[model samples]
Target: MASKHDIPLTGSSVNIVKKCGPALNDILNSKFGCGATFSGVDFERDLSIAHQKSSYVGPDRRFGVTLHSGVEVSVWKADLTNLSVDAVVNAANTDLQHVGGLAWALSKAGGPQIQRDSDDHIRKNGPLLTGEAIISAPGKLPCKNIIHAVGPQLTDPSYISSAEPFLEKAINSILDRVKTNKLNTVAIPAISSGLFNYPLPQCANTIVKTVKRYYEGVFFNIGHIPKEILLVNHDDLTVQEMERACREILAPHLAVPNSQTTARKTRSAAKTSTPTVQIANVCLTLMKGRIEDQPTDVIVNTASPDLKLSTGEISKALLQKAGPEIQNAIKNTPPKGYVIRTPSYKLPCKEVYHTRCTDRGAHGAEKVLWKSVSDCLWLTAASFYKSIAFPAIGTGNLKFTRKESARILLDAVNQFAQNSTQKMNVYFVIFPSDHGTFQAFEEQMKWLQAPRGPTPEASEKRDPFPNTRTPPPQISLTGPSIESLFEADKWLGHLFKSSGTIEIYNNFIQHFSHNDYVQLSRLQQNGVSVEEFFTAGHACITLNGPSDEVAVAALQVEAMLCSVQKDFVAEEEGEMLLLSSAGNNVPFERKRVDRSTQEFKDKAAAFHKQGLRISKLDKVENSTLQLLFNLKKNQLQCHATEEMFQRVPAQFCEMVSHVGFHAEFAPPEDPAYGEGIYFASTAKKAMEVWKGKREEYLYFVEAEVLTGSSVPGRRGLFLPPALGTEPLRVHDSVSGGSDISVIFSGYQALPKYIITCQK
Candidate 1:
């Protein structure tokens, strides 16, 4: 709690706040119930200042950029009536009645003349159809003219199917109005996305892409006429989406395809964008999306102390997807702590954690928030969950400002990253409509990523490795003070040592001679690898070599997880270098890459990016390049295992050893942990699970199981659950409490010793 209250804004944070203008002076003189303080170990005050700095972008806060075609596209969250554009586009219904949503607000600002003009247009032209538009003179509004465009209503199920095409037409109609009136500037809201039930991302993409394409003369004759077109919305989420759409659509070496071709274009892209910030092995990200769609191991919600989902949009959506079991569980359970955990019955995620704050900003809201967030993260990591997604949930009543809540959420993650040593992916998902909170988080991330001068060694220049496009992003927060930072560099020297060596690699990272960026998590397998976390953010992963060397070559082992789910994914990162047990000749650079086909060149280039050797001698003729590679199979041996199971059919008792299903006497398949080999914490627990009248030679293997990112072990499961966000990658193993450790794949575990007992 002390850590939650008296928090310091690192040396870099202090440097940032000292530069704030009058806001600094105002905070210094201001008086409040809790008393705010910035850069003076006050989390709340520093957060407020951060919000102010992020929100204020000069006098007008114009978030705009000029395109290559000299068309200035400005996207910002603001009142349309306040912006003095030549023409403003209104998202109107068929009858053009400005009664609800943004339409009413615009009409209220413009007075009764707008309604009268709309009525006149409808009477003269008989109710305007969807995708149609009618122009009207500005009546007390800031803009010179108004383009009342009829956008498709997405809420209607019958019209939902035709919404996209109609929405496109509506945008084109607005642009046509611009051309007809020769308007130099226009502001358009995200049509059909308000109460009309259209999605924000699609709405934004459609509008921005259409505008860009229209300017490029993709649409009949609607070429770039207006010097500036503003994609203004009242909410920051929509504005941010527009900005993102603009960047992605206009990036260099980029081509945006229509909806029909989107599938093909998206599939070719291998990697998505990186997290906002990466600390040690933890990646903290901010996503603008619905929590229900977030693919994480756990979905965290701020709930009542009794563990009930509130009647909010996010909660309703999740409840609807998960069925009524969650609500039913709440009725049966007693009052819990700040946090409670539940299994996701029908939801995409494995589990759900709910926390309570009750009061957000009244008094000591920071402590309550800190506990909720910290506990959720700690619990998730403890359960070996890889990822967790959190929505902007707060004080039972949604009375707190988005900025306050945003700051608290980020602060919690920051604290966790500072102290955590686990490799975790944490996502703070904001619904696309909450702009203020999104911007707050975006600003905090920018400040957090600021270079804190942790290591002066980062300033040094290093020789570039061959064939790597860019170096992997890894920073030494505390420099390489440990003696065993890169143990892989010294492995060759210790290979032939005929004894069990006790070499310690605090951080087992392999630096590829060809490319320093290529990281190999596992060098070998068979020994124990311990994991620990402290206040200092550092994670240690150790690997032990195979036992075929007649001596213990390595103490720690990094196990390679095998899964049937990853059939489509490549087994290795790229062209893997095989290490043979027997001494063999190093591969010679003699093989020439065939240059006749473009396909061969593309394959060679792709392999080159993954640090595969491709040498071209200066004196070589015919533009020949030599490739040095000798890929061999890496296999693991399975030891004899024995276990008991309930009486069942022979097919159910059958086991898979290495290749496929065989009639081998392996451990019985247990669905409690995905039908895998279950290991008890002790022999007593093993006996309790599988004891029978004929149990005499009772035993279990004390193997080094690779529990990468596990989910709860439930009945009827065949394989380990898929990794959070990656449906193709399954968890290395499944876990079930203090009694059992379920190894889904034989390759994921190595039998170290056997515990035999007689009952």
Candidate 2:
């Protein structure tokens, strides 16, 4: 047992004070009775605290070191940063700029200056040795300084031995500098996990433990000096897996304190409400009990989708309890199906709906479970039913973690029950054998047992509309025609903003290049500050103009209007409202068009008049688009995708054309990095194309190093700003823009009836 008098530092800052080295160690060890053992050095005589205020470290103290005499341990604490700090540890090789793990990413993100800085440092320091530390400029990083902490160099025979300790030393050296410079935050990439073959989990554990040990005593005082560390991981899975592991690791530390021991024990006892599950033969013994006699609706936890109407299976034990008729019905039914005998002799209610939980192990089953639960609740409520019984779902199937499943079911039930004004009760039935399930229920009951927050009636009784004291006032907006174009831009912008790659369907997006803008003078002349002109809620229709002409005009003016609207959004910031297109849905092709039809003939005649004659149109409509496209020499035939065909009617067919423009954004390259020669030209082209388009279309930019390039034999990726009729082809043969068809914007915007010679 440790004595209270012997403990110098008692709060959360213990580990933090220990990482700063001798100064913090001596005072804490002496005062706290911590018998820390320092390797090779006599810490008792050498250690001294430079600054001590009742063992309270300031929040601005980003790093610290302390020793605990009681435990005989030395700990180091340093703040981790989200942004770059004094030194960002890099996993680098002698050839620093070349592709590897952290090195490649750092090089890419930092731009070309990083390589230059690295080269300059190496020239002065010679080649860096494993465990060696040096300082350099951050290049393009947010940090002003860069601490190049080298790990062991890899060779054929693994240099694993020197790698581990070097990592530790590198970290220590950085922390040492942090204290010296009084710098607060630093971001750390998972060093040596890539190409070098360091195990990720082990590396993660080491980094976390080192940070934990160092900052044991000093974290609370680190003001703007971030004590919080954000681990940057490129891999999404790696981040999630590591996060889950960390959560589990921290769980033991956050366990309930002893103050609630007695209460916990009581709750634990209450949790064991059910006894062992007993299986008995099918039999029904009904006693006299009115339907209204039951206190509330009984909800059985189930693993099936349909609960209310489906005749779900019942246990042999339950069958014996329910007797012959119910038992017979249950035996023949599928699992989780519910059979309600209205006005039962044993309980209250006009009907009984049986439901089940979803099976955890069932592949592709969670969606089914969610859908089933929602369906049952919705169906039951449709009949104006007040309450129903439900069971613990997923307990038997183990589909969900106990606490998680309990919360989900209870939330769903509570939400459903509240949609009615009548009284509602959700009775959770527990089986004797399911101890874990029972524990979850008991835990929920505590919150359920509370006197409800703010309003108890809302908690106990269902109310269709809790805040129904006053009717919601109506709101409306009216704006100039410019607002309609703003809506179109917003709608298209959202579609393009979608995650992953976006592809435009059919000739709808291809036919027109829209540049929607109100002239700067027109905007001011109209007395519209761009706010009133582009407000989202305002529905502006071209009341007297031709719909097609108006739409085309809106498309052309959208960019200028969006630019204006964006400024307003920035100015208003918090006050901006949402705007959606009234009736326009994404136009997707629904059916394959007959290329030989009158419409096709008319289009062919129009194009022929323009000197762009089709050679062939593919009869088959493959891929997602039901488009009928034909190749003309330097010209292209365009049609709608399946989605567009289905969404847009034939009346809107005129909206489909052979010309349009779209744009994409990317990070501009640094000249200092020496144009990644192989990819530079393509990237330039891509930038040009993206900047030129403002309408709906599929666009792509790829940079690749082609064979036999004049600049260097070295390889690099290339970017080609190209438009495609479909998703970008990943096949290597089509390197860069080989597979993409670059539709000429100027040519697409040309009128269809202009006959001219092919120059």
Candidate 3:
């Protein structure tokens, strides 16, 4: 219902009279219904003529406001093409053709150059897909560049719900380009509202909301985003609609207080004297410093699967202090999601427990984080260590946010404390530089200290230690029996059963050590002294008796093995049990060895030593030739013209060729003679020629020839037959008039077996 006159004009609005002068007052009044009286002029006709001759030069200012994130957003009723900004957005079709209302206007004002560039882009990359955008140099427009954003066509009823996401994509694509190109300001049209028929209000809401969210989300990373985002439209009605949408949608978000301020206020209001959780025999303390400096009974090191001890700052520092012995002990160990104990060495702590934790953003990162912490506690408890220090496991280079890392870590420690019978002191050691991490832990501590109500029955049932020695009433594992394990009592019983524990350990070792000698060596090196069972089928090992050095070494070895096993399982599955002793100290390094060339050399030498004439041919030509070597018959047959037979060696010229060589000769010393010679033999013998040296053999031909020319002629071996030991029937015409023939048989280069044959 609001008219142009009703809209409030800001102080920046350009006065029409100031621009047009007194002569055009009568003309403006007649055309735009303005009724302003001049001091002394009644020249209405002259004013009308003057107004017709003049044109407006500047932007049509409407309304603008600065959002809470310090981004300037404006609603302007003016031609977008005329606005001088870094770029202007065009609501475009997926084809990127400038055919619609705004698109056509932009194309016209910008000249044919814009359309030509868009057409060229379409030709090269096909049509631009929906919810995507591309930039083009503005032709004659005031803006430097034009961003063509493709939104979903709302013509289909099914696409209604998807409009918001499409609009969001369009807005984000433009913003991304702006940031990438370091553009300061941009003007965007009311996208998808005209012939696209998207409702104006919804479109406006989407645009404003998307912009506000972008600024708010990236506020921390980029202090200054786009300096100004102008929502421009030539139509007055569209401008008014956008302004209204901005007030209703964006204003609320701006008015709300920042989240950090809100959190502080909430904490102050909930302040209390009593602690949030009070356990029987455990204490939780937060300390800020290097984990190595913490004087706990043991410290947990966040490590990778390779056990290189060179990833995070904490890891590097620990490794430097722990010395090379710790690295050497655990180098062969696989890194599973379990704790590995190693000697603290020069460290302040008595021992070190290492575990691999994933990035916070990865799948099941929370579960893995919890398991790492829990395993460390369980190992500490079993080893009879009263205190353990834990560094923020995944918070370092793993990119786990401080808040999430703290929450998961604290929850794990709290759960462990609630059920442990022995008194334990848990220290959360944080780096001095990570203030946010320290604050997160501090907040958690405050929350834990706040007074709470009675403990829930569900939580009480989750005891860290349940009686594991008691046997089940019977040993039946049928459907009902298996289903019964889901029950609380039965499940607890199943966890403690000696048979179950052994089965789990067997399975764990079998799966981890199968075909993996490194992991097997790690397990064997870290001798399994005693297996400590826990709730939920979790188990860890300790030294056979009470030797600290042996215990630390074993734990480190097992932890390394577990890490490697996890990586191998992620790759593929097999069941080849290969166990090796960790004490062997033989480093297993895998390298690629090519033996094909060597195999060829050995084969060539053997042929020579056995007194066979090796005639290296550079070229051979024949047609309708048949060379058949029958392995079962132990004979060679040839069918060819007399000229072809005469051209070949007299030893192989007979109609029925013999298996043995006609002349005695040593292996050829020249490289040319060595490479091209082929030995006539059975398929079985030929296949075995390169058995252990297949990779080094370079000769391409491996087929059993049935017909046609097999030799490469006097020039050289043109191309070895197909690269396989399988017998094949080959028939082809040759350019030469003469036809040559030889018995078909498997061939091998002598170099493959020269060393072995000579020995």
**Alpha-carbon local distance difference test for all models:** 0.52, 0.35, 0.51
Look at candidate 1 and tell me the lDDT of residue 151: 80
Q: Show the lowest summed lDDT stretch of 10 residues, model 3.
A: 747-756
Candidate with the larger lDDT of 1 and 3: 1
Highest TM-score among the candidates is held by which one? 1
* Deviation of model 3 at 250, angstroms: 2.4
Better of 1 and 2 by lDDT: 1
Give candidate 2's total backbone clashes. 112
Residue-level lDDT tens digits of model 3 in 45-102: 1111110211213565566778777888888777776888999999888766664367
Candidate number achieving the greatest lDDT relative to the actual structure:
1
Root-mean-square deviation (CA) per prediction: 28.0, 26.7, 33.5
Name the runs in model 3 displaced over 4 angstroms.
1-58, 156-158, 222-224, 252-759
- Lowest summed-lDDT stretch of 10 residues in model 1? 617-626
What is the Cα-based TM-score of model 1? 0.31
Provide the TM-score for each candidate, comma-separated. Answer: 0.31, 0.31, 0.27
What tens-digit string does per-residue lDDT give for candidate 1 at 1-759? 001112233333333333331232222112100111222322111111111212212222335667666778877766787778899888888877775556766776798899888888878888988898878987999899999998886645555557888888899899889989989999898888875667777878888888777777554455547899888875445665776787777552343443334345341131232225655336788877789877899998766544456566666788888889987865565534567777788888998887767665457666677668878987776565789999876622656666566656766776666544445789988877565566556655654554352211354222111232332211111111111112211221232242433232222122111111111221222242323222111123333333222122121121111111111122221121222232222221212234555644553464345333222101111111011111100221222332311121111111111111111123333335555656565444555555444532333333444455667787656677877888887765566775566765544443332222233
